[model samples]
Target: MGCTFRPHFGYCRRISTKVNVLITVSDDIYDVYGTLDELELFTNAVERWDINAMDGLPNYMKICFLALHNSVNEMAFDILKEQELHIIRYFKKRWADLCRAYLLEAKWYYSGGDVPKSIQCYMNETGASEEDAREFIRCLISATWKKMIGEQSMTSPFSKTFIEIEFNLGRMAQCIYQYGDGHGVRNHETKDHLLSLFVQLIPP
Candidate 1:
């Protein structure tokens, strides 16, 4: 996340962090707290992407939905003002997709059936060992990174800074989840990584 100090860069980082925090809050609501009916209402509100949709949501969900709506709208407003691009539709689609995925997972949980994770699915499909599945997953990740790098090298309408920011987001996710779901669960490894990057000093 290192960059030459610029107001634009600082604003981008702040908005990114805010979105990530909102995502974590949404995930917790889906996975830990909200009942199926409440989750449905919340997901529908998000899918609608309208303040008016908040009417049916419970109190907690109403607060979360309003926060998400306001933050996303504010970001969209900034982008529209600066870039002259109407990207709210793109943002809304992504959020809707995320909520749909979360809702599916919640449905799975309430059904009382164990769902195999990606690693397990790979192992089951290929009759591979756990280690082999992990290696396969690593290979897939590497290939995806290669593709992203290739895309970065190609021509695009986006500015170089914007492309780099998008690429860095992928890198950030890799670092955070390198060990596990670091964002979802606090672990010593993630704590140490953050500390070293943001808090600690290097000796010359």
Candidate 2:
């Protein structure tokens, strides 16, 4: 459930419209992009691709939506990695086994028409204080990416989009972390060594 870091090629065309949206109450991000703002970005994903109008999406359109999806997914990877490590460091095998079991359960629940329950189980597994559990939480985002974006829902069969999304996530995350040194002070919005280091790492 992790990205190996690579890029996928496709034509991305923008579609614009308003949407009825839900604001997620929480996040795990390297930076705090405003929730309403990101919500618009995501709602536009569906609108931009004309997803709401379609009864069923063709494979090509699905791929385009997946790309937009992953770009938003990138915003949270760094914070997810940080918390995953903390939990994994504390919980050990119990957390690992629990997450594994929960992964199975989530798959089962998803297949069995208990989607909200499945999401809850997935989140519960992630909330534990174990390395494996936490690692699952972090990498699971990639798993989700592969499933939704690559059309491979089973985590065991990951694809390039999944790997590249996480890879790009990691790169940008390192950029964000190094950009601030956790000071959360000074010119966070300006050019600095941390950002310079990020540029060196990814050449952005």
Candidate 3:
């Protein structure tokens, strides 16, 4: 199947404010493994409005965050693993707020952690009769393509082909509803006018 396509919306209510806050921090902690103290620093500071506390951190912080988030849940650890990789590919330097937001997608449902969204994406992408909430690895792979590869390739010296991030989102939603059952993506509905672009390209 091809990537998903969604129309561009000018902006959401807080997207602009959040984006400005998310990308303004001048740090990429992906490279530097944090000491116990360093971990506590950002963990504590993140709650506040200032991200400058993370400034100049190594590039490995992103990695550490992914690792920590995965360890928080096992049922969806596999999906979490791919999600981590997707974030790593894009930042290539540090973890961003958007990454953090998606990582926390599950928190909104099933109480906390990657409870269903991640698994739903996996299940939807794989189109597997996984019954136990399984997913195709390709969805996460496409995440890297849509968020990392496609975004990065766009500015690189190569042909810039954008992956349809919107399609992946639907597949994700399908997985959420399929796997989540009663506890589906109640926190955030993935449906959107954007899904219209898929037409015959992706399954509804």
| C-alpha TM-scores of all predictions | 0.88, 0.22, 0.23
The superposed Cα distance between candidate 3 and the true structure at residue 67, in angstroms, equals 22
Which of the predicted structures, 1 or 3, would earn the higher lDDT when compared with the native? 1
- Per residue, candidate 1 scores C-alpha lDDT tens digits across 147-172 of 98888878899998877777777778
RMSD of 2: 17.4
Query: What ordering of candidates by TM-score runs from best to worst?
Result: 1, 3, 2
lDDT of 1 at 84: 97
RMSD of 1: 2.3
Candidate 1: worst 10 consecutive residues by lDDT?
A: 1-10
Q: Which residue pairs does candidate 2 place in steric collision? A: 3-163, 4-163, 5-163, 6-164, 15-48, 87-130, 87-131, 88-130, 88-131, 91-130
Error of 1 at 178 (Å): 1.3
Worst 10 residues of 2 by lDDT: 13-22
Total clashes in model 3, counting residue pairs 3 or more apart in sequence or in different chains: 17
Going through the candidates in the order shown, the clash numbers are 0, 10, 17
lDDT of 2 by residue, 1-204 (tens): 122322323211111100001111111110233233343333343444344532344443344345434433332343357554333222233423432443444444445545343335655656654555546655865676556555433464556555555555555444444434333346554356557544756645
lDDT of 3 by residue, 1-204 (tens): 223232452222233334333333312231123443454454543433234544544455544433433322331343347554333233322343543443344234324334455557657777656654443544555565467544554555543222343444455545445423423234333333234444436666
Total clashes, candidate 2?
Answer: 10
User: Candidate 1: lDDT over CA atoms?
Assistant: 0.88
